[model samples]
Target: MTTTTTWALARVLRDRDASLYLAGVVVSGFGTSALWLASGVWVKDLTGSDGLAALCMLAMWAPTLAGPFLGTLTDRTRRKPLLIGTNLLLAALLLTLFTVDSPDRLWLLFAVLFVYGAAGVVHDAAESALVAGAVPAPLLGDFNGLRMTATEGMKLLAPLAGAGLYAAYGGASVALLDAVTFVVATGLYACLRVRESRPEPRAGGRRKQTAEGARFLWAHPGLRPLVLAGGTTMLFAGLSGAMVYAVIDGLGRAPAYAGVLYAVQGAGSVVIGLASGPALRRLGERRFAAYGIALTAAAAGLRAIPSDPVALVCSAAIGAGLPCVLIAALTAVQRETPDALLGRTAATANSLVFTPNVVGLAAGAALVELLDVRLVSAVIGLAWLVTAVPLFQNPASASRTATRSPSDANPA
Candidate 1:
């Protein structure tokens, strides 16, 4: 690392509250990552039904569709207390899974997963709002980058631990492990010391407050393009993900090859997490996002080829490029939004950005059966390239001064 990059990372780490917040994320994230993969496997083992196992994944994701509505609770409550309570509640809920000893109890598993997902939505919204208040503005990018690194690192490591525990001691043991982490995270949240200003009083009913976030996101010139770019990238990523099986089949490789590609991709994401802060400081969010999209476009186009080495490289490139857009969009939201609306706005943005991937996943699954894999890859690639045109021409990119919001200029 360069001297400057090393110094920037150290600066973020040195902040007491930022360090505690990141620690909470790391502990909680490890368990969540493990449970995410293990839930499907546990269901499959008990029921021997692929459809039921898939439903476990769906149950967890279904709550994201209601993120905007659930996020309003964060705006109404004190954020730190909400975060602490949410984690404790999730830990208690996971304990209920200890009763699932047979296929007849699978309904309980599904119900618990659904509630887990819902709590996650609220917890994330509150955390985003809290971070904007807790961390210094100059270090927000670095904090976000380190946060990504911690989560993605868990993605690489935690599943293995969860699976090993499950295999040796069964699903109940895995739930206990996850529950323990949540308790740890709750402690970390309790340790955080920061002043959280009370949110402004709502002028209207719940219905009106819910829509306020979406409206603000659309109205902000600097945020609008970055968010759009994130959604577009996820759409193509879903389409490309559907083509993975076909690519392996064409290469005359086994299903396990997909795991190799995933590991390579994770490695690339870790590197990007370490470097994104420096890149954001130099290029600004708009240009940083556009360049990342362009790289993803190029990588997606390369997936049309059948070479294994080329495919691995393209997977790494896709991983590196995608997170750049996500971090840029998140940093923009944090910098631009007022404290009063931060919780709702961040939640709404999460819903808008991720909902399209669910759509593309379904669409791509259907289309892949009817279309050629290479042709689908090419089309997704071209679509990403087209999406970048607006970013290149965005009026905010004309001058660095234009990208700073009034809140950023005079932070309270």
Candidate 2:
């Protein structure tokens, strides 16, 4: 809001370690988003079925349903090594696209997409866990804001970029650009100088680490509702996202228009991500979390109304609400959970939260064949809205403290 606040936010990005990681995230994000857009368009062009086009959406995200396993593994390994190795693997996979036609070997596309999703899970979990080690806990909100902004900004641009590249140079050329971006990101991760001060495992921690993380989430009187609401938001968001290609394809619009829509969605995310910190500071995490769910439901409801212009408006609103909910929930975890358990706790929550997305994407695609896409959107929208009612009903929403850092919440 104030110049001082803006200056403070800028300083979070200026930090040497944070800056390098942010740059890598931005480039890698560009690559990921480009691939998603290109692959979705490619699948539709080749298959000539809206259902199949929507299946491509499932291919891109369903593997992430196994995210908890990957998240736990990420916590066990060194961060830089994982990032570098996965980046290289993803790069190679992108390169392989030139040699094989995905249309003929649809299963191959699934395999590649699954690997990409799995790798993405590990990458995100490690990268986020590593941040607490780089920046002070007090500034976690600002740091999270910067990461969200970079990610969403990439989502906004990559679609347009990928579409143009596909039209002129083709999918192979786009894949080549993605491979180069990964290579650069890998190099940047290697060059980041700050060594992670890994948290000491708790006594008998090895056996109980995963269990404790699960128990922590289950026992948290406050977090259960937030997780449920997050899961609901993910479902609707995934459902709505799957329908984007169908909407455009049905109109006989170029895939580039899908990119434009994504860009607009990204613009909305950027605005919300930047403001998330200030909102958390003012609203406290709990009520803000409730508000995020409410906003998401409202956005999804708007989505069911069925007009191109209205769809864009709804998409942007939901896109904006997602970052707010994510930041609130993640910041709450960071504020309430212990340092020793941060990685596992994060893994557990992220996996559960994303599970509905897997279900939602598949269901969204399948539902469209049986019913009107707009009606399906309405059903999913109403479902998300009903699911979030707990956020408002829970008395804890009013009394929860938001400013306490993870260390403050857990003294050891």
Candidate 3:
């Protein structure tokens, strides 16, 4: 790495609050990734049913559907204290997993997992808002990029560790591992030095409070394109992802070969995430996300050619490109929204961007049954290209238009 690049990344780590926040994220991410994989395995082992195992993931993800609602809690309180309290609560809740010794007790496990997921949504919203308040605005892009790197990096290794620990000590051990991380994260959260003010209660009823987040996101011209492109990209990505086995079959490779493709894709994401800070500055969010989508689209189309080497390259490109819209959209959300509405706005934006991924997955599974993999790949690529076209404004112009002062924010 160049000295300049190294110093840029090190700056987040060297700062007091950023480093503590990043450390908390890294610690908890390892535990979260590990437990998610282990939960599925635990159920699979007890019930000997693939469907039951799959439901474990569904249990965790289902709570995100209520994300905008959950986000309002953060806006109504001081985020740092809320962050600390949620961590402690989850730490205690994870301990309840010890009771899941038999198939019959799976309900308890699912209940805890559901709560765990809800907590995650709240934690994420609070963290996003807190980071915006704590980190220097100039460094927000770098901070967010490094956050993705920490998360993606944990995904690469934590599952292996979870699987090993599960094999050695069983499900309860995995739960304990997660619980301990939360406690450590709680401590880290306590050490953060950001000052927070209690937000005044909104005049509306509870339901209206939640709707405000969605309204703000839709009305903002600058954020609308990035978030829409993000959602669209994820949808295409999901469709393309569902065809992984077919892509392998076409190449005459075993299904196990898919791991190699995923690993390369993940590495590509890691590399892109490391450079994303500077890339966002140079290309600006609009062109950055547009080009990333274009790269992803091109790679998806190329995967239909069925060469192993080409598949690897395409996988890396896909992984690298997918995060661009996500990062851009999130950074823009932090920069544009007023603090009073930030938590809900961030949550609403996430729901819009990521929920389509689930829809695309379901649709792609059905499409794969009816269409050729090559045809499916082409359709997704074309759709991605369509999404990118509108987002391809001049970076210089986009930067000027989008870098709005906070005082310009619309009142809720």
Candidate 4:
């Protein structure tokens, strides 16, 4: 690591609030990843239907559609206690899943999973709003990158553990494991030491207030481009994500080979996350995101080459490149939005960014059937390339961000 990024990461690690936040990410992320995989497995075991098994992910992700409304709740509430309470509430909800011993109780599982997704939306919005105040502004990049690393690392380890526990015990054991993690995360969140000052909610009905967040995002020239690019990138990513099996098929490899590709991709994410702070400091936000998207564009086009090594490289490149816009968009949202509107803005940005990913996945699934894999990849790559071009333009707002002192650009 560069001396600058090393120190930046060290600062993030040393700050009490940042450390607590990272710990919460690790603990909660692990449980969520574990439960995500195990729930699908549990469903597959019970119903013996691949379609039903796939619905577990859809169940968890569906509530993101309601993210703006959920986020408004965060804006009006004191975030720390609300965060703690949500974790505790989710824990209690997971405990109730102990009664889910048969396929007949599957409705209960789906319901809990749906609520779990909603909690995630609120928790994320609250965290973005809280962290802006808690962590120093310059270190936000380092903090966010580290958060991404911790999350991706959990994805690597948690699923195997969840699967093992599920095999040895049952689905209930996985729920218990997730519940315990939430309890631990609640304690971690309680331990964060930061002065949170939320501005009073503007006087308006809920609908108008919610609309305000969306309006601010669309109206901010700097934020609007980044958010739109983020959404566009995710849309292409979803299309490519659904092509994994097709990629494997092209390589004449079994479906299991995709797991190896994913692992490499996750490792790439972990590594790039460590460097993102320095990159963002040096490149400025828009350039950093633009470059990452460019790298992803190259990776997408190359994935059609049909070589195993090439595929692995493409996977890692995509992993490393994809987080740029997401972290950039999210960190920008937290930095630029006023604290009063922050929760709603962050959630709305997320909805804008990720909802397209779901759409892309659905679309890619259909597109892959009708077109050749190479052509699809080439088109997707071209699409990402188009998405990236606008971000490189010099905007008035970006000039302001670029002029901060080195200390402000880096970390404290």
RMSD of 3: 2.9
Where model 1 places Cα greater than 4 Å from the true spot, the runs are 396-412
Ranking by TM-score: 4, 1, 3, 2
Best by TM-score: 4
Q: In model 3, what are the clashing residue pairs, if there are any?
A: none
Error of 4 at 188 (Å): 0.7
Per-candidate TM-scores read 0.95, 0.81, 0.94, 0.95
- Model 4 C-alpha lDDT per residue in residues 1-412, reported as the tens digit of each score: 7899899999999998999999999999999999999999998998999998888889988988888888998889889988999999999999988998789999999999999999999999999989998999999999999999999999999999999999999999999999999999999999888666655656768887777678777767678889999999999999999999999999999999988999999998998899888888898789999999999988998998999999999999999999999989888888888788889989999998999999999999999999999998988898789888888998656455444421233211
lDDT (tens digit, per residue) of candidate 3 on 279-356: 888888888899899999999988888788889999999989999989999999999888998999998888888888
**Candidate 1: what lDDT?**
0.86
Q: Give the per-residue lDDT of model 1 (tens digit) for 1-412.
A: 7887899899898999899989998999999988988899999998899999999878988998998888888998799999999999999999999999899999999999999999999999999988988898878888888888888889999999999988999888889889999999999999999767666687778987877777777767788788888888888888788788888887889998988888888888888888888989998888888888998898988888999999989989988888888999899899988787788889988887887887888888898899898888888898888998888884544255356443343311
Report the Cα lDDT for residue 138, model 2.
66
Ranking by lDDT: 4, 3, 1, 2
Residue clash pairs of candidate 1 = none
Clashing pairs in 2: none
lDDT (CA) for every model shown? 0.86, 0.73, 0.88, 0.90
Model 2 TM-score, 2 decimals: 0.81
Question: What does the lDDT read for residue 69 in candidate 3?
Answer: 97
Summarize candidate 2's per-residue lDDT along 3-34 as a digit string, tens digits: 74587588877788878888999998898888
Question: How high a TM-score does candidate 1 get?
Answer: 0.95
Name the TM-score of candidate 4. Answer: 0.95
